[model samples]
Target: MCRCIRLQALIGLLFLIFMVPEFKAKAQVETIASQRQLFVDDFLVDQLERAELEMHRPVDEGIAFNLDKLWEGKFSLYTTIIKDGGTYRAYYRGLPDVKEGNDRELTCYAESKDGINWYKPNLGIHEINGSKDNNVILVDNQLTHNFSPFLDTNPNAKKSERYKALAGKKVTGLYALTSADGIHWVKMQEEPVLKEGNLDSQNVSFWSSSENKYLVYFRTVDSGFRSVSRASSTDFNSWDQGVEMKYGPTPLEHLYTQQTSPYFRAPQVYLAIGGRFMPNKQVVSDEQAAIMGIDPNYYKACSDAFLMSSRGGNNYNRYFMESFIRPGIGLNNWVSRTNYPALNIVQTGDTEMSIYVNHDYAQTTAHLRRYSMRLDGFASLSAGYAGGEMLTKPFVFDGSALELNYSTSAAGEIFIELLDEKGNKIPGFSKEECQPIIGNELERTVYWNKNTDVSKLIGKPVRMKIYLKDADIYSFRFY
Candidate 1:
């Protein structure tokens, strides 16, 4: 079998062959309801009928902000943006050159009201180049090498420690910093909180609403490849020993920065936009690099952004190996570390979300570029004009109705058939009775001739067989 088939089979390996009885013989046996899934990474999907994991490309929205300030430079990497209350804030490393310590690699800050128009204010936290009128947050310390921060979502979190961050490198380990208003900061402890795990990249941590613990994904070496590891903590101070992240049996590649974080809408699901690095994979010629105005050292390697996801564990499912946000139609983006994604994704419009990328890295034209995608439209089970079908694994749900986030061509349509636990099509819920779905919508209810209500199947083991023609089913949920 091909590697894709092997990887797909390993997805639900733990639950397979669990001696499930026939639906007619053991009907209405389920008691508790199963949790809803976003289908973000195919972690819950069991089978496919002709449909496959269709990768979605993010549309380029142009540069949202540029590092034109006096203090900012080409090496402003690991940038993080968060929607804090009514205001949006961005933080990143500000390194004018490949230097370390003494205001060389300082943590800088920026603010945006609508998350698009950004302004770097004079916070004056650090005195750089004989001036204090800059957006430097932390300076003269090695902690700014990759200072990563996030808002504390714990309900019982103290107001004084509303903002938390993790930083440091291989030798000194990771240091914890906290702030009440995200401006003034203090170290939680003098010593490192996590020392053994690698901290070379953006070692991100967040409060998992489902697990009720703080989870962190950091850099690591797995089978001699640049991989990731994960751990959890009850509090930010102490953490459990983590294990290397497993990407099923899929071939592991160099992930320069695993910018993993909890999706705001689905806290239980963690989304990662990692930089797939190709060391020594130089493509830009010396003349091409000069024409694009990129640094000479920046042309030694190449990289692009790839998507990954997890449900809070040591495993990250890479359902799609293709570039999530490709370096498109330009020579500047082909340079080293140019297409690396920032730390977080935020909702920029009513129906759109944006992810920032560091473009033209190590070049005079360095800037933070923007990419947008439809909400919950990362990957889809898509079918073409010839039409195809898909069957989900046997599971239970809680909501009274079924909703789909799908888009279809004018001549396209979608039909769903509800099946019992034994894979038998339930009467009145077959494709013949289901109304053909047409049009583009983010949320549309699926209906049948017997009525759209699915309250009867709320707590029972059921499945869905979806037929599609020239359409894309981005996601589905019981709620």
Candidate 2:
């Protein structure tokens, strides 16, 4: 063949290789990271507000919880996914013993076309118990049982053909499982890779972002009490000395120290959602603590879901924001339990996020519900370009009124200016400013007066300018 023809053929083959579904799935994650430079260009909206929250609801038999359907009859928990082919393959804990009528622990599989609607494969993937036909798939060499299986592609040049998984165990060691394909896993002979500290491998997760090295979130007990342990791994085998990440304030003396989930799904930004419990210590008089909604006790019910994080993962005390007011789910009569929340997060588009939580329904029954919110809600607005610029075109109101979704730390004056097509500012327009906030150290939204004449502003080109001295505006919705 001629040199030119040979080069053309090589290019065509390369293109075919990249077109494969498995290769494309991995590229999507890289493509998202490369496009990170295209952030929202406004001081009013911080980096957190750039990502929009799309659809969110209960992860049931519909779009949210395809993984649940596959393990409906089995005991399952700690669900995680790995994108393979053109879809996602999810694995969850299938404790055979937890079934209402059964008493054995096993892991199960569920595959999804879009990570939403799942189908159980009768492909004879693997076997469970003594039967090779059972839906519970296990490829690990029969050395030790497994739980908390995490899937990650290998990067090593020598043994790059394997997919890696980190499994947790009640006993003290961490096991490494490798698979040629995601389905069949082979546990390493030198199993229980690391068990340095007294930490029990509660859960294992890999930090896929380039910002951090591989992280393992372990569930450990300190002095025979529940605690969270964190460690890092390079080869997925050896790990750093595990250390407990202090969740709540100084430990209480009486109530049991609450255990925290080791794994959390956070977007690119430095924010994570997880659970923590506070033992109710009804010690104070009811009248003395009624204002704060406390039970006059030391540990008055775990505070609202805690937002625990650190700009620097090593420094545990950098920032801890706890919510006192809880967001209610009104379907079932699940008595409000403070902790025991499951983190179910999924990244849909370029900058859209969804967070699903497994909250308790009743004392024993728990329901898996989901809620979606934009990352922008967490950002703060800052001073923008001088001489007032048009950051976003004035979108027409689709509803009865326009709602500006803004966040400010202080309760202060707000100036809303409407500009005409010719860059002329309107004067004496509807102006309303009030100090309706209770504190100077929190986030609150301000709404535009719905009774105004938004109809006249709809037909013409307009720009709404906001003046926030020291606040963050997550987003603006004209509805």
Q: What local distance difference test score does each model get?
A: 0.82, 0.42
Please state every model's RMSD to the true fold in angstroms.
Answer: 6.7, 18.6
lDDT by residue for model 2 (346-446), tens: 54434444444434322223334444444443333443322121233332333333434443344443445555533356543323432232223222333
Top candidate on lDDT is: 1
Q: lDDT for model 1, on a 0 to 1 scale?
A: 0.82
Please give the range of 10 consecutive residues that has the lowest summed lDDT in model 1: 23-32
Residue pairs whose backbone atoms clash in candidate 1:
none
For model 1, residues 272-346, the per-residue Cα lDDT tens digits are 997999889888998887777676777888999999898766788887888888787777778888798998889
Per-model TM-score, in order, reads 0.90, 0.52
